[model samples]
Target: MKIEVSLLAGQQLKASFADHEIISDQSISAGGNAEHPEPFDYFLSSMPMCAAFYMRKFCQQRDIETTGLSFTQEVITLDESNPYKKKVSMKVTLPTDFPKKYEKAILAAANTCTVKKVIQATPEFEVELVK
Candidate 1:
């Protein structure tokens, strides 16, 4: 998959991938228009969203009800010495009346996020100016 990122004046940037377009901006204090989500916001959201997709699939396959299901994600920087990502955690909340038997399976399913796996693998990236 290929993505294109373009500057749109000031500190705003637009990223286009396939049929989707995501706008990234900085806060006024950060010298941006604050018109859209910051780049870090997208990065943080990717994990939970990917997990949620698998969670939904798990429920659908098992004929489980998806009402009142939600998740919370938290990021913690363990060591400032290690720049970039330090730690990411997610908590999946099931409905009060959710079946107890599926708890383990649900947790397992949510942990199957492809994004999380990729981050764990720590893929290498190469950056170069486009000619």
Candidate 2:
């Protein structure tokens, strides 16, 4: 899918893709109104959201109750200025009634998230000046 990104006023930006639009802006301190989350925030969140959806779908397909299922994601960086050194940690919180036998299966399901796989594959990117 091709996504078109355009600059708006000041530090605000808009991304338009098939049937959807997302707006992003810098923090107020960074000279934007902070109308929405920054672009990096969306990128950072996409992985965990994708993983959680996979976990939930796995539980649902197996008729497992997801009432208490939850997850937390943490990002660690050895140096704040170094994005390449970042490490992401994701934790799965199982419900009280979750079966012990399916523990590994559930983890495997979450690990199958497409977003995580894409990052691991290190897809190449290209940019062009469109006059």
**Tens digit of lDDT per residue, candidate 1, span 39-124?**
99999999999898998899899888889898889999988988664777689999888889999999999989888999889899
lDDT of 2 at 71: 78
User: Of the candidates shown, which would achieve the greatest lDDT relative to the real structure?
Assistant: 2
lDDT of 2 by residue, 1-131 (tens): 99989999989999999999999999999999998999989998998899889999999899999999887898889787886699899999999989999999999998998999998999998978878
Model 2 gets an lDDT of: 0.92
Clashes of 2: 0
Q: Per-candidate TM vs. native?
A: 0.91, 0.93
